[model samples]
Target: MMYDCNLKIYQTLNVQSEFNIGLLLLYIIEGSSNISINGKTNMYKSNDMIVINDLDHYRILSSKKSVIACLFLSRVELDKFFRFNKKYYINKDKLDLSVLKFYMNKLIVNYVNDQSENEKQNKILEYINQLVMTLHLYRKLDGTIISNNIDVYSGINYMYEHYKEKLYIGKVATQCLLSVRRFSNKLEEVTGMRFNELLRNIRLSYSAFDLMYTKKLISQIANDNGFTNESGFITHFRDKYHITPAKFRKQLENDHYYPFHNKNTTLLRSFEHINDQIKYLTDRDVDYVSIDINMKNKIRSKISTPNLLIYIRDIETLTNNFQQSKLLSMRREIGLFGLLFSHQLFYELYQSNFENNKLVHQMFSFSLEHQFDISFEVKLGKNQNIEEFTLIFKRLLNYLTDCTYFYGQRSFQFYIDASYYQFNRISKIIQDNLKESKVILVLNKQNNYLAKRMSHKVNDNKQIACKVHHEIDSDKDITSILKNNPSLNILYQPNIPNRIESLISIFKWSIAFNQNISMIIDDTWLDSMIPSQSTHLMIKELQLNKESHYQLFELILTLKRLRGDIVYFNGLILMTHYLNEYQIIIFPNMKIFNRLHQRININGFKLGEIEYRHHDILIKNNQLIINSDGDTHQNMAEVSFKREIGKLIVQFYTSPYAIKHIYIKQKIN
Candidate 1:
């Protein structure tokens, strides 16, 4: 590491500066100044800061005087710590340079104190690393960072959507309207993978999903995903995953908590959601339940579910039954943590009922009965006028204040339902009020706000999350979302996928990338609570019904147990190592649904008591053997199983989602 002592200390007072060869960090010490960087002008007041990249031109103008400390560091050196991609830029509105300012101040003091060059170099390097981390840098594909080139992304997108078909660099280049050579260069720049390499990854990623989620044969999967032959596909799969396709599938199955295709019919039916099936599952494991309440629905009997999220479509239903619902009583007795209703209904209620109205007072009473958080789904319609919204917002504050008096300040959270543009308007209003409560700006699938860096400064209490009404199962889409909205949480609404396995894969992707997510499954998607006829048949056991729904719930409960550091995550496998346990979620990334034939081998785990399908699973001689026909096959490949290491391998069976839970009695000593 090298530091140019000549550029160590500088005081800028209404002067222009250019960073043609290195990065410059400008910190405002006193007074206020107008600064322009790369043609974007913003006011830099006391404690304000900005990082100007190399080759960027910036100018400062102060009316009286301003003390600005500028530290210029070689960008080439910074690249050793971070890629410093050209496309990465901190928007003026989105900049949170407080952390950077702290480091910059320390580095400046070191320079002023005349520290040793090596010491200064080490400190400066620490500062540079901190700056990059604070920015929440996105991951790079292969080695190349995400490119901003529309053509390059377009080319990638073209390849992604049609990777199943025969693809050539020329065909994709032509689709992106770029020459072969130009497209090849751009693709390499964006992915750090050549045309064939990138295409193979795309195919392999999809094929991997198929391998886990579908029952497609290796040859068919390879052929469908555009691989010329099974051997080539196996070679590529092994090259990327470091395992043969057969072995990879086997490992996923053996590690699963419960095999989806269990041979025993009696064991499968035991997990189905019958008459109190939801209650049974929730009693065992479930953090919260998202249930809808309508005007016709009466105050039903309450179950001992820990947390409740009451979804009220309109105010009429809320006013009609919310106060009377057993949920309110449950909140007081046990504790239902949260309630949700639409903002439209709230506005209508306020307009219909005067201030200090009886209904509003009663609503506040029920909410204040327990210290549960209230979330209002604030939806902004297309034709909604800002003036009208502002007026309603004023009334909302008054309404919130009345409740705040009872519920205490900052107890309410606003769930703003808005498009990308609408979010900007409502967020500004909320911020303008100086409200410290948590605000979640919820966006829809059509809104690409997640991909674009938000221009609004998200306060400490505020978090923005994208809420999609549909299922996002594509690996590419998940990767793109995680990369673009590194700070945003994800909320999936209405229904869990038809297949629990798909969701397991999605959850793995989120966990692997260290992203926060919420999945809400509405009652409607459960296909009615009516119990289906019990047949001693396997096919009948695995149909999509309430049983399967509850099974999904059980799977969610199991998934939540995976809490710790994500040691490794590729598209195919996710490894999470916690203090008490280490969990692995392995799924194939196929776009289609098919039945899989699997032979699994479990290794690296100490065999203890195993809980699978309510039967005692024994590991003999470090090998677990089970045939497809409810019989033990001792001839299978033997793997090491140690008693010192216990693992929970949850496997999803067809029709019913069976969870295999292995609890380690002792921690690693």
Candidate 2:
């Protein structure tokens, strides 16, 4: 058997091998270079030696003035010399040349020095034998060589080679001559993962490589890697790399941030970006601006002064409803009463009729289309069993999740009125599922006590916000009741109070404590009113006088300027004048907005010199246009109205700094 071992020096070499010429050994004595085997790239510095088997195609790009030593051995001759049938497998491409440096120098010296040909040949054989034994020992210690013992190492190697196939533990155990349970334990010990986990990881690794290199379709790659579907592949890829395969590939192509290359560093940079944005938005100097209470009180006193009524008489006629009893009788006569015949007939009929009415239907449809909040009511029968309660709660949750998927957006929050036990169960389910959806639970007197008690039992790490509703006179009583309940931060909702002092106190308390205050205005008309620090405002079955209605509009604008919290107006038909100033407004039904516009004076307000740029505005004679830009566009609103009405509403849904000034002109005709 004959093989070649030579010491060669090269200043620079850029070679792409078409075929591997036996086992090629490269020892770099000086300088550094990069080598690419197939598409995998690796760098080798000074004193590094690399062994490339005949099975691989490789390319070597040497740095300037680099020196390298090369040796080549035929597979047949190497097998004959080592007394082994199969070829040698180096665990890694690169190894430290230090161990072989001394022997290599000695061999060169012996060959160069004067000596008999047979003697030199004998020394060469001994040296080559020693090198093979050293590699074998190193391979064993590196855990990269498969042992000949057919039990453990061979079984693992087989799994690694055939992971894409449908593998069963029992079959593999039988092949390894071991019991199924023992094999399972041994597999876990060897891989540090269960059989299924290890198999999935192998497939995932291959898929990742293909994604980085191949131009194959994601579905085809998924199928090739034994994934049931593209979604499964995508889900697992996201879990491992924190991004989808397509996104990863795009990042690689664009030479942008690739998380997988240096995961911890990229993750830290991402967190830093988020932290910077948060700091910019919530800078203490900006968010915590101090407003003098004395000055606020003085301004409030001036604003709350009652003025002579400037009423729109037509609004009353437009919003007036037909006799309810007469409408019900007509429905019964026409045999159109299906659920109306039930015990809670009126409530059901009201909800159904309200939802089906053209204006109401339009409002609901528009809200859904624009991804605004849609409220659903769930009423529990008296004294229901736990199982029945849990089922209803679960159904409600499922509906919320379905809504999130259907809308293809997640800006909406769910509002539910539940008992203490029901809220407990719902909270547990939310925590277990790790849902990101927000839920606002409305509490009344009956369950408020139990909620406070359960607050103490909750985990401190858990986040919970409670809104408590109570009568105006019971402010001190409610405060005392909640004194011991430090675990829950309570927000108060007192029914609309008559005095301005009470309103100011409530608003100040809300701001001071970072809690919400709520008010329900039900038919009581006050002479003067101002905005409070209330998170929610529910007007229940109430119609205000024209002057009072105008005051409420002013209150809405003031609240918008103050906290910027979402205010929900339930069971109230807001006038067009009230709707003009808001960026986003939601109504219970479309009919309410329609009715408000029926006798609406286009001359209701003055028009401004409008500039229409982009797809931001549209005007149709008497109607107000509202639109959302599909799912990808968020926090945006586009509205326009004709100048014939002399009224113009300019609502900009962007950062405050981007707001444009409007030029108003009084109506001419």
Candidate 3:
């Protein structure tokens, strides 16, 4: 029986009653509408199309000024289409119909004009058939085929519900009222998997969920997921995922705690404790040199100077007021300064602010003589016009590139303050620029969506740096970002809690994510914390109280455990001064250590037996003396210590060059 195709145009708000007869296709050509299918709501914008199947109970809520073209295929027509092409069916509700808009418009025009000739009617039917076929072909091309048979649906539902049970194919076959052989063949035919394989896959998938979301024991997870034992589960998981379940969990934790820039880059979460401790040490004017056993040898010939990071608020004011001689003198006093400029300040200067330009040129000249890096901080919200901003930024970067080239230095970097909405729009531009030049793109406190997007675009050639401005709580979001982008250089803000537990949490998190982190300490905060002291007895007066000592020790230990770098802002001078006297060196984690051992094969460095303990650790003669926390010392070639010390002295161990390439390769895996 042939049934006519019905076409209706919705001009304004329109409601369609729930139906289970015909296959309905609603095309929004001019505007948008909201579609609800079984309580699940999705918005269909302009040039969007949605297909509602006979089985799907749906309602459409059209916009006030929407132009919707609705076409219905009667049950007879749907059945005839399915009989010939049983494997092809519309699976997705919403589809971007921009490509089909022309064809659909023609069909709508013909239907509205109502030319009732037989050929015209046949052409209308052909268009309807063509639309359905296109929808089917598109789904197949996109790998979105839906298993529509009732037996397959029921089997999948039963498997999902009973995946934890140790059930055999016979049991499922019995439940489905089929013989074991027939059931196996039917399952394979319907879902493209043998019954056992399907069951195992479901169990494995669920086990992964438990491993990531739950802190359950591996044995417990194995048992809960119907695996015979932990070893079996581990073997299966490793076979499928190429990483141990424990590593997966660690990765999840790391991604949760850090912001990922790319597969190889992650931003460490901010820790207030480290910052407070640094502030405390700087405030007390603690004599870090005096505590060092090698102070006389390291500091006797050199004046203690911290690394400097200078924040340039008004380059115009500085350049206008100061003489070049003064600028040169100021440059002579500082070492390794990082000059920061806000997006607005740079934009103004590039707009031909003469005084600012002069200041910039002078600064570059000073940097050429003194060796300092220029850091541009861009806040995305400030630029209302992203396209315009991109153009301006490109010009500024080109100018900076030229300036750096003239000065024979390449230390110009960008710190972008991005959010979800802005990053997506500018990601391509950023990626293109990254490929064309050598510049570090520092993303600060980006949302999950932007972070994920940026992470996917990262490659080995690009230098992507990520900084965490706040804590992240969503494990799923974090894990997704990290799983894709692992080679992230994480920068942690030192404003997080200072508790040992918190520090340990951060350490474990970093290791799990398999990324290196750096602590960004603000020099302004450090300087404000210090008290005025005369140069005469400064060393004697600069003493840490017991609490300050404990805080500093904890902070140092935390940094060491995480193998974290310390980036001193304006306080680089003070940091360098202290660093000269004492170094806080962290041993690599066990996984990293084994890799190092295999690659470096350094004398006295052994793998597998090394254990990290916290007790009395001493640094003397460029060697670490670790007091065993256990009663007897284990036969280990290397050991790490976590301890509270009165006179702590440290020396850093330079990592093997090969270790970096190995580390990056490991992360990629």
Worst 10 residues of 1 by lDDT: 285-294
Which has the higher TM-score value, candidate number 2 or candidate number 3?
A: 3
Off by over 4 Å in 2: 1-364, 375-382, 389-400, 411-416, 428-434, 450-474, 481-502, 518-543, 563-669
Query: How well is each residue in 299-326 modelled by candidate 2, as lDDT tens digits?
Result: 1111111111111112121123422232
Model 1 lDDT, residue 413, Cα: 68
Clashing pairs in 2: 359-590, 359-591, 360-590, 360-591, 602-645
Estimate the Cα RMSD of every predicted model relative to the unseen true structure: 26.6, 29.5, 28.9
lDDT over C-alpha atoms for residue 558 of model 1: 49
In order, candidate lDDTs are: 0.52, 0.43, 0.47
Residue 11, candidate 3: how far off, in angstroms? 83
Better of 1 and 2 by TM-score: 1
- Name the top TM-score candidate: 1
Candidate 3 C-alpha lDDT tens digits along 31-55? 6788897568998886676777543
**With candidate 3 superimposed using the best TM-score fit, by how many Å does residue 401's alpha carbon deviate from the native?**
3.8
Q: Go through the candidates in order and give the clash count of each.
A: 28, 5, 27
Model 2 score (lDDT): 0.43
Q: Write the per-residue lDDT of candidate 1 for residues 1-669, one digit (tens) a residue.
A: 333321232233555543233456667655677889757899878667767643345766765344556655443333333655443334434453544554555555444444676786676666556555554343222324223577776676577668888888899889889999998887666555799987887687667667755788999999988999999999998887777888777766233212111122111112122224223322321111111112122222211111234455444433556234544443344333366766656777657654657867666666566555677778777677877777877677767776666667565667877666777677677656637666787655555545465635555666776664444544455467667666666665544434465555556555545567665544233221222233453354345443355445445544554555554443433444444454544343222111112212233444345322222112121123433355544322222222323332333211011223333333433
